[model samples]
Target: MDPLVLGGIVAISTILVLFSGVSVGLGLLIVSTGFLLVFDGLRSLELLPEILFGKLDNFALLSIPMFIIMGASIASTRAGADLYEALERWLTRVPGGLVISNLGACALFAAMSGSSPATCAAIGKMGIPEMRKRGYPDGVAAGSIAAGGTLGILIPPSVTMIVYGIATETSIGRLFLAGVFPGLLLVSLFMAWSLYSTWKYGDRALLASTTYTWKQKFEILPRVLPFLAIIVGVLYAMYGGIATPSETAAVGALLCLLIAMIIYKLWNPKDLWLVLRDSTKESVMILFIIAAAGVFSYMLSSLYITQSIAEWIATLDVNRWVLMGAVNVFLLIAGFFLPPVAVILMAAPILLPIITTAGFDPIWFAVILTINMEIGLISPPVGLNLYVINGIAPDISLKTILKGSLPFVACMVIAILLLCVFPGIATWLPDAVMGQAL
Candidate 1:
């Protein structure tokens, strides 16, 4: 069979299986196996074990589980609640203060966690209740949390960045450094939108402001200081050549465990079991997806599908910027239906060659791709972050969550545009730190 014809069959079958509620890992595995059977017969089955091992052999991939455990440890403790409460005390005087505080908390959590759904859950659990008590609009409150949660992937220590770096052979440390500024930029844009929306359309009846004494504010500092220390320690170790990204992740996870057990006094045996159990499940799920994507990507390469797509793209007469825009649009559309990791796994292999051939920096493009994926997290229908927020605050309908997330989605678009126009926004820090674009 022609490779293109086979490609279409594989794509359609995979999509149908996914929409039919099969897990992504299983769906990809089944589709790839079917293609292998059709194309190479029984002999292809022998390659499965080798393919899975090769895919999972990377040292950098070890970081995924450690980072996940680090986040889970924080989540299992009082740290998430304390972080939100502290930010709320500090930001309550600002317009749309509660929402701003929620965004702030999400940013902080994203810095530490590297997972969007985890960030959404940690902040939403605390912020939504407070917003309800303050009479804030459900849509805005839920939307702020949903949209802000996306920072989990754009910010440093992002699991998505790690996956992207591994998939593209880009530097994971540099990728981490590159995300810092864009993450801050998104945080600013989200907060600005919150302030503007509150001033322009928020219910004044629900916008009650609070005052905190100097002593009171200082008291909350202890609650967040340890987490800050972990962030600082991890980054410094990676940048100062004290540890690799994987090593830094291990250290960070260990620190989080100690903090939960010692400082927070929150780690009982059952709590410990829950954190380990949850982290193991999440880590295993991600790895399984990676393994399955490996098989699918290999099949695409073997069939020459990716190369044909790239060559076809290369022949297009459109300007590189136009191509970039189209890629962003495609990714945005894909994001609405796919998770960031899945998008990266499927799109990066095909698009990276086309993008690099167009003469764009791979590091800068990674940031852009990540931001686009970030928007998808809160996008309507299958956006994971939206579902996470809705699950947390079930009374807030999915419609309300989607409505609230729209503004933040706009904020993300603006951020992407800014990054495109001034690629330095994403590249400058990493360049300065690494002394070259990684």
Candidate 2:
């Protein structure tokens, strides 16, 4: 069979296997092995050990688990509640500020945890009930956090960005820098919509009391500022060249563990065990997927399918913008089914070359891809954040969650459009800080 035709079959078979409830890592492994067995014989199987070892030997990949540990340590504690409370105390003076606070908490926690579902769950647990008490409708209450939770992957220390950086051989530091402005831009857009929706729909009679004193507000800052400092420190360590990505992750994880233990009194053996267990599980899962993707990639390359696809893409005579649009649409669709990390590992190898060859910066395109992943977190079928919100507030149906998330999705779409017109939102920070990648 033609390599292109075989590649098409392999793609469909992988999707079917995944849709049939196989775990992503195992599914990819099975797909690659089965396809290679039939077409390339046992010789391809001989390369399996080398492929797995080569993929897992990456030292930069250590950051995934370290960051996961960092996020999990904070997540398994009261940090989320304290962060939400801290933001609420400060922002409550403004009208419709509770919703804004929830979104703000999401962004901050996202910076801290780098996991979308965790961000949604952490903030939504308290933030949702608090909003309902303020007479915000179910949709508004659930929508803000669900949409805001998507920020986790867009903010620095993001696992998705890390995966993309490693897979595409882009600078992890630059990728971290690339996300800063776009993440803030999305936060601002989400907040604006929050204020508008709350004022238009939330009950004035039940608005949160704004009568708290300066002393009360000041007291909460001590608990929240340290974690905020950690966020800044992680960004600084990565961008300032003080540490490599893995070293920064190691230090950041250590700080997060220390802070959670001190402020939250999470020093109990059971609590520590929970943090270890959760982070280990999540980290292993992500790492396994990476290894499987490596095998899958090897099969494609060895079979010459990757070269065929690239040649086909090169032959296309369309304008770069048109090519970009098609890629974005495909990414948006891929994100609907796969998590951000999976999409990056599966597609970035193919997409990055096309993007750079067409005169677009891979760094800028990283932001665009992250935003699309943000949209997927709230989209139907496998919208992880939406389900997390639903879990926290069982009364709110998935339909309602989707309704609330739609505007934020629109906000994401607008951000992408803006990035298209002016790619600097993604590129400028990295270039200024790192002296531009050659």
Candidate 3:
């Protein structure tokens, strides 16, 4: 059978199964196994154990569970509430200040937690209700949290970055450094949009302003100081060449636990157990998907499907930029259906070769692709962040959350275009800080 035809059949069947509510790991496993059995005979089944073990044995992937535990630990504390209070008190005078503060809080939390759902759930629990009480529009309140949550994976310490780094054999440290500026840029863009939306569309009569005394401002510092220390410590250790990404994640997790137990005094045996349990569940789910993706990716490679597709793409008469645009479009559409990790796992094998062939830097393209995934978190149908917001604020319909996210989605699009036009936005910080691509 033609590889393309077989690839098409595999792709369509996988999508149908996934849409039918099959877990991503199982869906990928079933599709890949079926394809391998039919094409390569029963001997191909033997590769499953090797692929699963080899893929999960990496030291770098250790950071996913550590980072997840760190995030979950912090979420168990009052850190998120304190951070939200601090930002809200300082920013309330500005237009859409509350919403902007939500964005800020999300960014801060994203620095610590590299998962979008964690960021959304942590901040949304506090930000959404407060915004609603303050008479902010439901869509605006929900949208801000949902959109801001996407920052989790784009910021450093991102689990998706770990997966992408391992998948492409790129340096995880470089990917972390590359994300710093783009993450900040997206924060700025989201904040700008929030300000504009509130000023233009918000009901001024209901958008009450507040002032805080210097003493009050100083008092809020204690709530945020511990988190800041953890962020600085982790980044310093990683960038100062003191530790690898896994080491940094371990240190961060320990610090987060210490803060929760000692500083916040919010820790208990029960809560600690819950955090561990939740982290284990999430880590297992992600790692399982990765293991399945490994088998599927191997199957694609074994059949020369990815290479044939890349070669076919290379034969096109179109300019490289046009091809890049097409890739972006495909990713945008895929984001609506697939989660970021799945997208990176499935697409990177096929697209990275084509992208590098066009003389683009792989690190720069990783940043660009990360930004695209950021947008996907807020997009419809399978937008994880949107559902996260709805789960937090059940009264706000998914449609309203989706509506509110449209503006922020536009901000992400603008950010992506800017990154495309001047690749420096994503690369400069990594180059200046690391002195070379890691």
1-438 per-residue lDDT for model 1 (tens digits)? 766676677778878987888888888888888878878788887988799778999999999999999989888777778899898888777768888888899999888888788889989999988887887788888999898888999888889999999889899988988999999999999988888878787646244666889888889898789988999999999999999999999999999999889888865799899999999999998888888889888878877888877888899999999999999999998888888888898778888999999999989999999998988888876899988988899988898889888888888889888998999998899889888753
lDDT of 3 by residue, 276-295 (tens): 99999999999999999999
My TM-score estimates for the predictions, one after another, are: 0.96, 0.98, 0.96
The C-alpha stretches of model 3 lying farther than 4 A from their native spots are 202-207
* Backbone clash count, each prediction separately: 0, 0, 0
Candidate 2 residue lDDT tens string, 44-126: 89999899879989889999999999999989988999999988888886777888888889999999999999999999999
Q: Over 4 Å off in model 2, which ranges? A: 202-208
- Please report the candidate that would top TM-score against the real structure: 2
- Give the winner by lDDT: 2
Cα-based lDDT at residue 261, candidate 2: 91
> Could you tell me the lDDT of residue 371 within candidate 1?
90
